[model samples]
Structure formats: structure tokens, C-alpha cells
Target: MDAKTCLEKLKLIGVLSFATVDTQGNPQIRNISAIHYEPDGMYFFTARGKNFCRELLENEKVQIACFEACPAKVIVRQPPISTRT
Candidate 1:
């Protein structure tokens, strides 16, 4: 599928699973519904004080997963750029 199509499908799914590693190197996962998609990539929101935000700040790498129940398909992606400064 094309990028546009994939993005559309993700939007239809509404919520996506985001996985990240904490400072202790443990895996953390959360469901994120607030996202903004652009041609280049997508942006998701989490409170600055939240562990999810802290994990993202500490570790740039993240895995996003989307599941389509009807088709039984799973899409996983990792951002090419760092999310932290």
C-alpha cells in the first residue's frame, strides 16, 4: 500500500499502539489516539509529565503498531528521525 493509503487506514483505526524503552531499558507501551499526520510523518501527543513522554525524551526510538481486525493485518513502524532534542 502507498503512504497515503496507509495513513488513511491508520486514521480510520483511530488509536495506535506506541512502544518505547525507558531509561532502565524496559519496554513501555501505550495507546495513543491524538495524532496529527503530515506528508512527511505523524505527530502524537502525551503529557510532558507522563512516563510515555519521559521515555520518548530519553529514548528516541519508538515502534508504532496498528492492527486491522477484519483483514488480520499488523503494521509496525519506527521513525527515521529522533524525537528528542
Candidate 2:
């Protein structure tokens, strides 16, 4: 599907489940129910500075996976903001 189609699907499904690799190369998967998807990318709300934010800071690269238990769209991008920074 194209970006627009993907976005529409995302909107219909607000929650997203994905994983992020920390500096240690450890895979951390999180189920994010609150996500704000923009044209550039997606955003998540957290405290001013949290470990998850630090995780994003440590590794700008991330994978956001969403699907209908079938075809999955794995999005790879650097979140604009990290919980720590």
C-alpha cells in the first residue's frame, strides 16, 4: 500500500506494536496504544524524560510494526523526540 493508504490504516488502528533496539543491541518490543502519526512520521507521548525516550535517543533508528494480523507494514525511521532528550 502507498503512504496515504498506510496512514488511513494506521488511523483506523490507533494502537501500534513494534520494537526498538537499544545501544546494547537488545530488542525491546512495546505496545503503544497512544500514537500520533504525522506526514513526516509518528510520535508518542511520555514523561519529560523517560527510559523509552532515552532508548529513542540512543538509537535514532526504529521499527514501527502494524498489521491486521496479516500483512505487516514495518516502518523504519528515527523518532523526532526521545523520552530522555
lDDT, candidate 1, residue 10?
Answer: 78
Q: Write the per-residue lDDT of candidate 2 for residues 1-85, one digit (tens) a residue.
A: 5666676667767577767777688898877888887874556775546566667767667676776655666464445553433
Q: Which pairs of residues have clashing backbones in candidate 1?
A: none
Tell me the lDDT of model 1 at 81.
59
Root-mean-square deviation of each candidate, in angstroms? 2.4, 3.1
Find the candidate with the highest lDDT and give its number: 1
TM agreement with the true structure for every prediction: 0.75, 0.68
Residue 52 in candidate 1, Cα distance off native in Å: 0.8
> Model 1 over residues 16-76: C-alpha lDDT tens digits?
9988888888888899988988876677777888998887776667887888766745465
RMSD in Å for model 2? 3.1
Model 1, C-alpha of 77: deviation from truth (Å): 3.3
> C-alpha displacement of 28 in model 1, angstroms?
0.6
